[model samples]
Structures are given as structure tokens and as C-alpha cells.
Target: MQDGSDWYGAATATFGDRVAGAREALGMTQPELAERLGVRIKTVRGWENDTAEPRANKLQMLSGILGVSLTWLLNGEGDGLDQPAGEAGARLPEIRTLLSELRDIRADVDNAAERLARMENRLIEALTEGRVE
Candidate 1:
């Protein structure tokens, strides 16, 4: 950290940030990673969104699958992907903002889907009860 070469250093990147970066660097989608790690897609989503984390066994498997050290994924202090250079590096913050926005949208979609399921169940009950006109 002295030379400041690590863009996603321990001070800046969270566990989720490192996990997402490593996954993206390997060209893997959340579903793909989740399947490989034998977890649900939402589990992967939760990990990336910082809403949840994996267990120790899953963490080890994740590091192997993503080609990053467990230490780096945990603290961004070991062997890990380098941040893009020059122009790309300049856009890193912008990229992060967009990713944040996308994650928000994903949450909205999940919420909406859950609401739809509840509504559908209610409608089914209403029909069975002869409440609908």
C-alpha cells in the first residue's frame, strides 16, 4: 500500500467490492458463479450487494473459482486483479456508480417479483372464496 499501486486497497474496497471485481474480471455472471459455488443466485447477489456473506468453505471455493486469494478477497491485500490503467482507471469510480445503480435496480426487480407473487396468491384465494365479481 505504500507505493499506492493497489487501486482496490483494504481501505477502500469492501469484501463485496473485491468479490464482485474478481468475478467480473473472470467474465463470470452472478448465476454462473453461484452455480459453480453450489449456492443460489440470490446468495451471490447478496454477497455482491453486501447484504450477506459466504461461509468459510464457500469462501475458499469462491477464491479458487475466481482466481483470487482469500486474503485479497477479504482485505484486498494479496494477489488480485489490477485495476484498469490510465483512462479506464480514471473511469473506475464512474463504473462503480453505475454498478451501484444496477444493483439497486436488481433489488427493485426482486421486490416487485415478490409483490407480484403475493398478489397472485391473494387473487387465487379470492377466486376460491367467490369474492371476485
Candidate 2:
């Protein structure tokens, strides 16, 4: 005798169900998850519908992004939304690292833009100071 409650558990849930559960448990929308994964919304939809499966690289990234183990994401056997509190805390380090990297990249771009502006100003000054040949 089995009640339908099992359907909601990872043990009997479909792949799509697990994906959607993890995404929601992380407080992420489909679009946000897709953007983080660098995938199209349609691709995400396909995955959630069980029409497709992510490749190994994407699977690894998906697990990390969703703060779940690969096995849990695949078969609901390891660690899924069953432990939401711990999962959320586990993702902090990765998020912090990503934020730091983005800050470094932004700084590099700003420095390059400033150097380009200075070069342009120097060129303009030289052109205005000299007579045309």
C-alpha cells in the first residue's frame, strides 16, 4: 500500500521533477537558472520536461549551481532538497568566489577603458597642436 506522497519524494520522482525541485529550493527562477548555466530557456524547459538531459560538463555545473550532488540530481539518491538549509549554506563559498572573479574582471575592463581614453586624448591634442601637411 503506497500513498501518492512518495511521488513528491526524490526516490520516486522523475528527472524533471528533481531538477525543478532543486531550482525552486534554491529560490531561482527558470530563466535565472538558465542564465547561470549559459543555456537557453528552451533548453531548460526541455530538461524539466524530461525531453533532454544535460551533458556531463553541464551536469557537473548544474549540480554545483543547484547546490546538490550529481547523484541526487540524477536519481535523487544523494542530497537533494531534502536538506535545504545545509544546501543553501554550501553554495555560499562558490557564490563568493564567483563574485570576486567578476570584480577582478570589471576592474580590468575599467583600466583598459581608461587607458584607451587617455590615448585618444593624447592623439587629439597632438592633432590640434600641429598644422596639417
Candidate 3:
């Protein structure tokens, strides 16, 4: 049987920092997550502060609710908060190509955001008094 300390270790090792980080990453507060899990806010706080450990069933529920793999939630491997080890014999060219494409898309999105920001600023200035130079 898994002891409380074991559960605590797994939660800390997998989550690092604190369970709050994982909860926050999923855009949930203690009350919000507690509602989702049908638990009390204090239970969530205990998990975050390491004041108590979750049972196995709760851990599994948390893994699913938090949108992380069970293995990752337990072991902190395979796309956990940290990056996993590279697959063996993976070609560097493929990674480079994907990275280049991602960068190009990011640049396009950034340009669009900048243009939107400028337009919004101009609109605000026009409403306030004069055109934004």
C-alpha cells in the first residue's frame, strides 16, 4: 500500500515547486479545482502545501482532471512540467524543420498582434482627442 509520505513524494517530485503550480497551469484556483474534483477547497490547499497527500484514486482523478498523463503526473516524465529525453536515433533535420516552421508561424502571429495593438491604440487616441502619430 502507498503511504502518505510516498504520495507526498510523488506529488512533489512530479509537480516540483508545489501543486499550486500545476493547478495554476491548468488555470484553476483551489475553489475552482475543488468544485471540479468534488472536493473541498481546503483539500486542494492541503495538496498544494503538502500538508496532506491525496489517495491513489484522487491522484488518478487529478491526473485526468489536470490534463496530464498518469505516468507524467506520477513520475514527472514524458511531457511533464519538464521536457523528456530525446527519442533515440531521431534525425536532427526533422527537428530543425519543425522548429523553423514554428518560428515562422510565431513571427506571423507577432506581426499580427503588433498591428492590432497599433490599430487599437490609434482608435483609442482618436476617441480621446487626436490621431496617434
Give the winner by TM-score: 1
What lDDT score is found at residue 6 in candidate 3? 26
C-alpha TM-score for every candidate: 0.78, 0.55, 0.46
Deviating ranges (above 4 Å) for candidate 3: 1-18, 82-133
lDDT tens per residue, model 2, 44-120? 86677666799999999998998777887777776666533455446745754664465456556656777999999
lDDT of each: 0.81, 0.71, 0.58
For candidate 1, lDDT tens digit of each residue in 1-133? 1222256677766788788888888899999999999999989988987778899999999989988887888888777878767886778778768877887887788778889999999999988999655
The prediction achieving the highest lDDT against the true structure is 1
Give one digit per residue, the lDDT tens place, for model 3 in 21-99.
4677678877998898889876775565444678898888887787656565555544334322365124534654554
Q: What is the C-alpha RMSD of each candidate to the true structure, in Å?
A: 3.6, 13.9, 12.7
lDDT of 1: 0.81
Model with the higher TM-score, candidate 1 or 2: 1
**Model 2 TM-score on a 0 to 1 scale:** 0.55
Which 10-residue window in model 3 sums to the lowest lDDT?
1-10
Q: Total clashing residue pairs per candidate?
A: 0, 0, 0
Query: Which residue pairs in candidate 2 have backbone atoms (N, alpha carbon, C) closer than 3 angstroms, thus clashing?
Result: none
